[model samples]
Every structure is written in structure tokens, then in C-alpha cells.
Target: MPVQRIFFGWPVPAMPPRRIAVLLGSIALFAVITLVFTLPNSIPSGPSLGRFTDHKISLPKLPKTFSSPSILSPFRVAAHPPPVLKNTTSGDSKWYSNWNWLSPFSSSVTLDENRSLLPPLNERPPIYTYYDHTQKKAADLKAADNALLLTWRRAWWAQGFQPIILSPAEALNNPLYAELQTLELDSTLKVELSRWLAWENMGTGILCNYLVFPMGAQEDHLLSFLRRGKYPKLTRFENLGHGIFVGSKAEITAAVKTALDNPELKTAKDFISTVPKETFQVDPHHESVAYYDPVVVKNKYPKIDEAISKGANGLEILNKLIISHLHGTWRNRFSKGIAVLKPEPDHMSAAIEPAFTLAEFLAQCPESPMPSSCPPNRPKCSPCMASTPLKISTPPTYRNTSELYTIGTVPHPFTMAVLSSFRDNIDVPWIRRESSRDPWITALTKEVSGTGVSSAPRIIKFKEAVASEHGTFHTLWLTAEKEVPQDLDWRFGFTIPRNATDTGKSETPVPGPERRPQPKPDPKNGPVANPDDVKKERELLKRAKDFGQARTPAEEKLRGAIEAWNLADTEAWRFARAFLARSRVERLKWEEEEKHYVGGAGAERGKSSGWGRWFDD
Candidate 1:
């Protein structure tokens, strides 16, 4: 019988030790197998690929103005009230209401009405003007109304200025505005304190000469005339006329501060006297009507020298002769002046209407499928319009004058549009063409866009002023030379000095700042490497490594673009040189072939006529 173990109370058999050992061995084998499979996954591999890899890299914080971040900056942006569509009394809609459906992008949308669709980087500069509803004088009110209307028409519609019309109340919201309300002003004068405060708050260096439009008088030629001259501090009339004041954002803000701080100044001339003498230059073509004209004199005007003043800041003197004969002379040129007088009519309507439909504007845009290469045809884009209007269609006239070759518009409009819609602070490259100038050094004293040149300090100041309005200055380069200058302060923006082959090495140093002091020879180590030289080498190696070993998909794509841009720039010159070389070689080969054929023909003729063989021999 088999040995049996009693379950609860009986005797047990003791012959199973070998079987128990086998079972235990089997359990151990299974545990070992599980550990082999699971331990590799559970344990951290290495710092480069394990826990460290899981941590996301933190990019450096971008500048406040860099890449137009939509961070609601403390700096003020000029605002425009939405245009009223319906006429309260007539019950008829304005002309643009019907035009909403005629939009180029989509049938239901108007481009300007939806600011979301406008190009993100390079926006048109705002031209600030204002009117006071509480004015007691008819002439002052009418003058303000008329000046604002014509100014809007020419500045917005004709010249592409973004017009901003602020109210007296809007300006008074600033504590500084109330300080200005006490100064004396002429009955015909409309003080531009509102405009000054708005401009000061705008925190940009964009041209603010259009402020003159609302103050003295509006002229059809005034805006265009101002554009032709260097930014003038004051528009001089023949007889110390202080009717019109014009200047840059700096000049205007300074003058406004002077006027506000000085309460003793009475007349426009006194206020003008406080401004710097550098601003007091003669400009006969300034052409605004005389401040002491008969119409102005009849409106309770005082003698040129009075001691008491009453408006907000002495800025009331800014437009002592707000309306001139030009207002009546050119009144019908823009519009009937009826829409302007209406309290509800939209000032911005004329800007986006009849001159060119929003559809036409969109069609000519660089993002369009087939946009015109002409700068004038395309809507004003800062990056594309950096150079003068003349230089866009052709290369610069002078040799080595340097030209910024724009890569036209990138074709991925949908991606750009989406990104812009989200207001992402990403650096979207505006230009990717080979520059004859290195941009880094040129931007120090001259505009890379070829606007003009100035002292390095002044240029830097201007850049700082405008950087908030425009984005931070940056450039992408595929150098025509072997290396980028090591001396330029690369701290300004991103710089990737790459070659066509991507060899990640640079030989010849491009022209740059003076060499820094070289390291002294060491007794033991021979010589220490120059910091700049080492830095440059490290940069090249680092950039190459980063480019090749892009850890993520986004980085990989960005590197790909870098590669493409460099290749495109280099290939442009390479192909051009290759074409020229091949053409010359082909031409020589053709000439030789022709000579041989002629000789053979002559020999045949000699064989026939008996003189060809003698000539050949």
C-alpha cells in the first residue's frame, strides 16, 4: 500500500524530500526569470537617458519686446474704437458694412475689422489725433473736426498710417493730463494735450509728425511733405509762427513736458521759446497758414505777449491756429466733410475702403499664393520694406553698398497664421537671404534695412526706442565668407554661422572688431588659448552638435531649416559661379570644334580644287 499522511489526527509518510526540493528549485527558477525581465526596466539606465532625460529643458526668458510677445506689457498700445455701422437717423448702413462680404480672405470677413488677420511682425505706425466735445467755440470744434477728417483720410487711406483718435476724457485719465488743463488757450486753438499724452504713453519711437495735423491745419501735401524731410523738430512759418509743431516721439514728449511743467508761459510763442533752440529752424514749405491770420485775430485773440494762461499744460499753444485756409481749400478733396462732422461716423472706414478693397490688399500680400515683388504693390511690411522703395526691385546701385536680400514670403501661411493667432512669442524669421552686409556690425551705426546711417550711440538709442514697437533686431546668416566675426557682441540676437557643407569649422576670420589681447605664453603649457577664439570654436562645435543631435522633433525641424537656409544661400553663389565657369568652358569647346570643322571643310574643298591640300599642309 502507498504511504498515507493523516490530514487531521493520523500518522504521516516521510519519503517526499526529493520531490519537495525539486518543487522549490522550480519556484526559484521562475522568480529568477521574472527578475531578469523586470529589473532592466525598473532600474535607471544612466543620467543622459534616464531621469534626466525625463526633465524638460528650460529655455531662457525672452525679452519683454522680443518677438512681439503678447504678454500685455506695461507699455500702452494705442486703441481705436470700433467703427459704427448704422446711421442713427437715416437707418442706413455705412459703405463698409456692405463690403464686409467682399473680403478677400473669406467672403464674410473684413481684414482690418479683424485685426487677427493682419501681419504680426511689422505693423503700420499709429498717427494720434484728438477732438474735445466740451469746446465752447464753434470755430475750434469745427476746426478740430475738419482737421481730424482730412488728416485721417490722407494719413490712413493714402499713406498707411494707423490713425488713433482719443477723447479729452481718455487723456485726462492720466494724472498728467489734469495738470495741463489750467493753461490759457485761444478760442480758435484746440490743444493737443490728448495726443501728446497718448504718444508719450505709446512707448515707441515710431514717427509722430502726424501730430501736427490735428494741431495747426491739415494739408494734402503736409503728410507727404513731412516724409520727404529728415524728422524736423518744429515746422517754421515765415514770422516766428508757432502754429504747427512737428517732431519725433522724443522731441514731442520733451516739449510736452516743458509746457506742462512751466505754468508761467502764456502764448504759443512763449511756449515755443521754452523748447530747445535746435528745434527752431526755418521751413518755408511747412506752408500751414499764419498763426495771426485775420480769422484767428477776430476770435478774441490777445497781443503776442500775455502773462496768464488757462488750458491743460501750455500745450494749448501747440495749435493756436488749429484751422487754416487749407481746411476750406482742401475740404472737398478727401470727402464731403459731412461724415467727419457726424459724431458716429467711423474715421477708420476711409482707411480700409475704396482706395483698395481689403480683397485687393490681401491679394498683394506676401503670404498670397502669387504676390507681387514690388514693394509699393504689397502692403507695407517692416522686414520686407526695410530698404527704400527703390531698392526692392533691383540690387543696390553702388558696388559693396550692401543689400539685404529678402527671401520673399515663406509658403507655410497656415502654420504662420495659426501661430500668430495664438500670439506665441516664437521667433519667426522674416528674412533668410544672403546679405552683402554682416548686419551685426552694420546695425551698430547704420540701418540694415538701408533707411539711413547715424552715430552708433544714436542708432542704439533709436533701436531701443523702436524695439518695443518693432520686435528685437535679429538676423539669420549663411555667410559668403568662411567665418563670422568673432568680435561682434553676439548677445544681441541669435547667430548661427554655418557654411554650405556644414563642416562645423571656420578658417578665415571675416572683418570685425579689433582683436582682443591674446593669452600670454605659459612656462609649462606653451600658450593659453584666446577666450574669443575658444568661444568661437566652442560655439561652432556646440551648434554643430546641437544641430545634428536634435533630441526632439521640434528641434530636429528647426535644425533642418538651419541646414536649408545655409545650403540655399551658399548654393545661390555656388550655382552662379558654376554656371559662369561651365558657360566659358562650353564656349571654348564650341570654338575649337568650329575651327576643326572649318579646317576639314577647307581640306575637302582643297581636295576638290587642288589648293585646299596645300593650305591644310
Candidate 2:
């Protein structure tokens, strides 16, 4: 009755209960089949209840024939000691211990039995001495003076001139003598006399010698010579006490004319005019050479006209004039202060006679002609005839052989003399005798060799016997040609070994401080294992595990190799974890893409399906 009366909603249908049950059963069957085919076999249904438990209980049984080491035996139970190790053996004690043979002894020993076998330690040093040649003839003068005076007289006579000697005291007191002195005759005396005698005349010629007359007497002699109108050759034109000589009146007059004619000479004449007549009279009779008074001359003639006229250009002229005046003034002052201690005639004669004769003969002879005294058979004088004349195109240039000899040898001569003087004074016996193997000489030899000087002299080698006797060792000497620069002060230092004796053996070892111990290396910071070793270890472990047993050395090495393999595995696991982590991140991105694509496809399918339904209707 209810079915006849019932009204259903749109799209609903009524069915029997049996038909509904069959439909539900068919749906359940379909779902079971789909799940069976789609699910993965690897996925476990639940927790592994007893799978690993069974494996743990079923250990492989040993065969009856196998004989394992007893568990209680020391061999089976023994374990490698902890990795920490101790170095008890002396061989492994310290790195330096390996060289213990070189260690220093605790105490020095004196073995009397082998005293002769060992070399001696104490030795003597080398010595050097020097000598001077310039002062060799200083002890004799009278003979020189006499010879000089005679030569002067003869030269004057040959030139038709006469010389007059005067007392300075008389000259100063007498107006006539004073007038004569006022003419600068005394100042220009040497030059005037030399010129009058035509003695290789040159401008402002200079003559040098040791002094023998008082300054005042020299002045008086010069004045008298000037008044005589005749020239005389100078005995000894040397620095001594007061004034220089004119030697003749003709020389004086000629000098005056020369000064008056040349403005430059006028200055010099004016300077000479200022000298006090009385100043030239002091120690009037004293037999000693004297110096000129530059102060008096400057006071009398304060102008530099002579300097200007002489073409004294730049600093050179100024220096020359100043030096000349300073020297003259110094000599005059020195003479005034000197005590009038008369020298013996014999002493003077001994020092000067021979030199004076040689000088006079050399001066008078025309430098070109050979002397008759020369060997008769020779075509030219062997010693007198020089290979070439001395020439100096430049101011500082030197050409005379004698001058060169003097320049090269003079300084060293004095130094040598000083050194020689010290010989007896020094206490060391080694210092008295010159040693050929001296360090200074050796150094000098090395230095000369390095200089590449083509003509440098070779150093003399010492005799072995002499060196052995003196215990002298070869050394280097550094001798410089000129003063060293302040900036290069290091060059002044000479290298000297601590031990100077040769000892006929190798050099002694230099002592040094004790060495410190080196620290041991840290394992963590030790050198990394070789990559090939790591790879080989890995391959060995893999082969052992694959075979299920160790067979060879390579396979047996896998006992501890698993730990190394674990390290590599850890590295690979880290890489896999990173890859998986990155994949999860990409999965999220893919899910988002799927959502978008699915949403779009769903919308399109709905529209298409609806249109098809519409067309079918």
C-alpha cells in the first residue's frame, strides 16, 4: 500500500535490498584485487616481530675437525696494548742522541804520555816594520854649506857679478841699509839671484832646503847682495828662521824693475816694503835659516793686486796666495819663538855638503849636455842622460822621474821609519822581525790580485821553516790607495780569525749553543692517507665480504679494513642524505605543478563532458 502512495525526489530510484547487497559485494571484490596488484612487495605489513631474532640465534656451528684456540689461552685472550707508547730504548730516546759522538767532554784532559802527539795551541803573531828615506841626510850640513857657498861664488864670478854679505844689526841701524831693505830685495832675493845667473829662469821659481841662517842675518845678507849689483848662487835656500836673499844688487834692481813693470808684481813689492827694518835685525849674527813675515807684508800692502795680475783665477789663485803668505808668516813667527841654539859646524857640514855639490852641478849643467865626468867610453852618460824630460801639461800632473819617485815613496817612507822606531820599544819578539806570512801582507796580496792591476807586484811567500818556527799563519792585508769614504767605514775593518796559528792542521771548530728538542707530530694533523691506499683498502674489504671469507694477504688485511670502509661509507651516506633532502624539496615543487595541471584539466573535462551531453540530448 505504501509503495503505491510513495513519491520520490528527482533522479532517485527504488531497488530491492538483494540487488543492493550484490552490488556492494561486487565493489568489495574489485577493491581487493586492485590492492593486491598495486601494493609493493618490499613494504612490510608491520613491525619485524621475530625475523632478526631468528638470525641472531642461528649462529654457524663449527665442524668437529676444527680446532680453535682455547678462550682462556694467553694468545686468544691477549689484546694489543693501548695505542699510547713509551720510548724506553736509548736508540729511540732523542734525535740529537744519534750524534752523541760529537758531544763535548765534561773536562779537558792533559795527557802527558801523548804530549808530543797533539799539536800546540800557543803561537806567535807576524810583524811588519817601516822606514823613512827623506831624513837620512839630516845629520850633516857644514860640508853642504861650504860647497853651496863656493858654487854660488863661482857662478857669480862667471856671470861677472859679486855678492856682499851684511850684518842685519848694521843694516837696520843705518839709513842706507834700511833704504836698501825697503826695495823688497830680501823678499825677492832668491828669485832675483836665480834669474841674474840665468839658472833655467821661470816665473816665481821656488827653491827648498833646510834652514841654516837667522832670519835677520838672511835679510842683512840679501840687502848687501842687492846693493852690490852682482848675483851670487844661494848656498841653502831652505826654511829656517827669517828672510830670503837677493844675492846681488843687480838682481835686486832687476826684481824692482820687474815689479814696477808688472802691476801683479807691484802688490808683492808693496807687501815687502812694510817689513820693519828692525824685525830683520833680530839675532843679526845667528847662523840659521829664517822665514818671511806675511803679517808685516799684509799690513804694509793690504791689496791683492799681485794675486789679481798673476791670473790667479777662481779658488786656485786665492788658495795659492793664502798658502804662500800663511807659510811665510808661520815660519817668521816660529823663528822668533825658537831658542838660539847654535848647531855645530860639523853637524851642518855632514848633512849638507854632498847634497849641495850635487845640486850645484846639476843646476849649472844645461839639462841637455852630458857631463865630462861621465864614463869616457859611453856615447851618452848612462845615469846623467835621462830617457825623457819631465813634462806637466796640467797643474796637478807630474812627469819628472825623481818627482814621481818622491811622490810614490815619501809617505810610506815616513810610516816605515815610525814603525821601525817602535821595534825595540815593543816587547813582543814577533813584532821585531818582519814576517813574510803576515796577515796584513796576505790581505794586501789578495786585494791587489782582485784589482786586476796589470803590473801589481806579487806578495812574497814565507819559508815553511820560518813560519813553523814563529807559528805565523798567512793572513790578508787591506791597504787602500786613498782615504776611505765615511759612508764606507766598513772597509776600514780587517778580517782576523780568532786563532792566528797555522798548527799544521785544519781550522778549529767554532763552539755553539746546545740545540733544543723538536716536538712530536699529532696524529689528527698527520699527513692524509694516500687516496690509492684508501681505494685499495676498500676493494680488499669488498672482495673479502663477497667471498664470505679472507683468503690472501689482501683479503686478510680486511680485518681492520671495515673501519676505513665505514669512513668512506659515511662520506657516501652524507652525499645520499643531501641528495634525498634535495629530492624532497623538488617533490614539493612537482606536487604544486600537479595541483595546477589537475585543476585546469578538471575544469576543461567538466565543460567538454557537459557539451557532449547537451549535443546527445
Candidate 3:
């Protein structure tokens, strides 16, 4: 008999089966091993687009661990019960019962008040107020009888998004108004400069209409200033803690009147003043601050009432009609993607103002000198015309999803304000917190199971297998960024006990309403060995969620410590389960590959022209 060869601590068997399994297993294990890397979720994933689009990665079937809490639970705190005082002497062994307040484990955690990335409270952006101005040549203003009409620029005449108003000081200091006094102002400069003076935040309103809801709540206030507050009934309402609101003029007016006239409409003294009244007048007399009487003008003009009398249900619809008529309904969500919004000059400035607002644009540059002719308080160009709309490019899956959806027919603003611009005051975390846990778990499980896996760790590996595809989707939608680099990596985030877990098996049945027979417990594939432990985990996660939704400061501190403990425990759990899954998956995969190879080429190779065959020949 030939002496068996020893190689790398493994006896190279003369027999085919043992040697074949060992050889393939080693090769497969070496192939599957990879170095682990962790990164912050906020790290931008942009810089690669086409690569993800070209080659689609296949998602693995996730394990049952990825199920909804009703089916399976991973790791999460479900409810945060206030630690009730309990007697350790009672035979009960719940975690909260063994309270030694001085014990390090029982110590509470606190959020760092100094940890906020938000700007200082005193440094909030100034609430913008628009100045009222008149339409037609400066000479034509003297002919308009209604002083409110004098301040008003009729919808057909103004090309910008909303109505314009100017202040008393602004009337004197602004160079645009001073230029209106000049006799030689060219027809073009006259139009451009003249349009510049007629500023209203209509573009901002159109933008508000574009968001799904309260995202535009603050800017929506600017609309009240539009047209010198002619629509007092429409503009003066309290938008307290309810969802976003849209209604006919009568509805909003009634709501506002009740809030102002009746005390009951007030909820939580949170309502700041939002009375609607004119802020400017079109002096029939040549440029003078003395003629600015908003009350006298409004009582005479009453533009909103006139519109309603003409069958315009309310000011919102009136404004919305103008917007939709001029620009299409862009509020409907289109497929998500990359778009570069370039600002276009509004009709008012098309003949007069350059595509870029020279004064405002130049002022942005470092050490750039302002033109002597421009006023100390130079007027801003229209947000609608000057803003470049965010022309975004959608990824493959998101692209096809919106194919059947309708969008605005009118052209998009060349330069449109981005959602970020409106929400600059908001701050996000260094480690962004998870948004919706259920959706993410569902997504991961579906991929891991392919159709179903028995364990959580396998589901995770399956997640890694299709990282590029699903990872990209999560990064994009999760971070709220438009695109991320093709190679971008992501991890889960937590909000409180300094962080954030999961457990459970399905209690429900399918169509017949009968419970499916439970598979016999196998050491290799059975229910979790400790059922109580899973229940405890589920309870802890529920508590963490409660802490996350904590409205007050006291409850929030306990939540942080709980979150940290949960996260640490979860990671530890994942490591153990994942290691097991990795070993199992590797072994199974290797066996499969080995079987295929041996039955085809490897088996023949391992047979090695045996001496028997030689002798037979």
C-alpha cells in the first residue's frame, strides 16, 4: 500500500471522499473570509452612479429572523416601563426587580445637552417680510383710485410667483425705486429694474404647495404677506400640532376668525400672532412715505373679497390656479433621481434682469465690492426665477416605478429652492437614527430568505450578498440624499439608552386559519433554546421605542442608557448568530460546490489513475 502523504496537518487520504471534502472546504473557507469594516450612516454615499445602474447585484433569501415583530424579532426595545420599585425577596426574578440603586448596572444615563449641532437659539433666521409695490409704469400708478389697488400688481401683469410689497424705509433706500424716478431708464432696464421692485414670495408658496405637508409650514406664512395681505381671511390661521392643512378660503378664514375672535381655538398658548393686513400702498402721488395707509387701501380695494365674488372660492385656490395655470402641478412625486435646477429669469425680468441677480450673486463672492448704484438693502431676485430647480436623476428601480405617474405639464422653475434650503434650521445626528424599523427589517428579511432562511445570521449574510442594490436604496432614501457612491457602505443607527434590538415567531396562521404544524425541535434547527430570553428582548426593544418617542426630557435620559445596552447586546447577539450562520452557510455551500465538482471533474481527478485501472489495462 502507498504511504499516506501528510500536508498542512491534514492526512491526504488515498480514498476520494474524505480528501475531496477537506480540499474543497479549505478552498471555500478561504474564499468566503473577508475583513469587516464599519462606518457612520451619515457618511455621504455619493460619487458612483453608473456602476450600480449597469450591474445589478442579486439579493440573498433572508432568514426568518427578518420577519415583522409578529413573525420574528431581531433586537429592539418595545416599551419603556418606568422601573417600578420591587422587592428582591419576592420569588420573582425579572431584571427590574433586583434593584440596588447604587449598583453600576442600575445607573441611569443622560444625553449631553451640549451635544446639539443645532445653531444657537438666538441665531434663528430672520422672519422675512415682503414690501408691497405697484404694477404699470410709475406714471400709471397715479391713475389707480383704490390705494390698495395702487399697492397691488394684478396677477396678469406680474411674472414672478407671488405679490410684492415694500416698506417705508425700503421705499427711500432701495436703488430700484430711485431708478424708477429716472426719465431715461431704457424700456429693458425699466422692465428689469421695475420687476425687481415688485417682489412677492409667490415662488415660495408654489414651493410649499410642492412639499407633502408641514415641511413648508414656515414659508407658508410668507404667503400671508403676499399682495399686501388683501386676503386677511385666508392668511390668518393657527397651524398648530395637526398635520398639514389645505382648504378653501372660507374654511381657512373661518378657522382663522375663530382662533382670533374665540379663545377656545387656541391650543397650548403656542399660537404666535399671524394677523393679515396690508403692509404697503401704491401712492397715486409720486414716491412719498407719507401715503402708506394699508387699512385705508384694503377697505377700498379688498382684492380677496373681489376674487371670491367673481367665483374664486378662496385665495389659496386663486393663487394655486395662477401657479398651476402658469406652472404645472409639480407637487405629485415623480420617480426619485438627480436633477440640477438652473434658475431662469421670470417674465418680469426676462426682458430686464439677467439670468443671475447681479447684486445678490456678486455679494456671495469673497471680498466682492457692491455696485455703488445698488442700495444698502438691495432687493433679492425671485426664488422661483433665480433658483435652479433641483434637477435630480432617479436610479433604475425608482425610475420605472414613476413611469405611469403624471406630473406637471408646465415647465419646472429653472432655479427652484431645494427642500434643504427651507429646512436649514433643522439638524441631523452624527450617527443618524433609524427612521422606520419595520420597513427596513422587512426589506432585509425578504432578501435573506430569497424566499426564507431559518436563522437571523444567515439573513444578515444574505443582506451583504446584495449590499450594492439594497444598500444603495437604503442610503439614498435613508439619508435623504439624492445619490451615493457606488461603493458606499451603511450600518443601522440608534436614537437612545445611547442606542437601539429584536425576537419572536409567528403566532398567526394562513388561509385555513389553522396553525401550521410546528417542526419537531432539532438541535441544529429548532426554536430558540431560551424562550424567556427572547420575550425579555422583545420587551426591552419595545421600551426603547417608547423612549425614542419620549416628548419630555426626563423619560428621554433613561431611553439613552437602554438604547446603548440594547445595541451592545444586539451586536453581540448578531456576532454569535452570524458566526454560526457563516459556518453553516459556508459548509453547505462548499458541500454543494464540491458535489458538483466531484460528480463532474473533481471526482475523476481524486480517483488519480488507480493502480487497479493500470493493471486492468
TM-score of each: 0.25, 0.14, 0.21
lDDT tens digits by residue: candidate 1, 419-522? 22222222226324322222222322233325454233332332222222211211111111112222111111111111112223444465643453444543
What is the C-alpha RMSD, rounded to one decimal, of candidate 1?
29.1
Best by lDDT: 1
Q: After superposition, how far is residue 434 of candidate 1 from its true place, in Å?
A: 45
Candidate 1 residues lying further than 4 Å off, grouped into runs, are 1-122, 136-156, 181-243, 261-263, 266-270, 279-617
Question: Tens digits of per-residue lDDT for model 2 on 213-236?
Answer: 112211235423432433343222
| Superposition error at 335 for model 2 (Å) | 35
RMSD of each: 29.1, 48.4, 33.3
**TM-score preference between candidates 2 and 3, better one:** 3
Instruction: Compose the digit string of candidate 3's lDDT tens values, residues 1-617.
Output: 77888999899757777888999999877666532233445457887565769686778988766755744554554444443332211111112322221122222211221111111111111111222223333422322222222112222112112212322333334433553455343354333323223222111111111111111111223322331323322222222111112223343334333323433322323222222233112112111001112232134325534543444243332233222212211111222313111112111111111111211221121110111111111122122221233233211111112212211001101101111022111112311352221222222234334434333443244223222222212222211111111111001100001100011245465575446665454332112223454344334333333433433664444334333423322222222222222223323343355343212211112222222221121
lDDT of 2 at 349: 20
Off by over 4 Å in 2: 1-170, 175-245, 248-400, 403-617
- Preferred candidate (TM-score higher): 1 or 3: 1
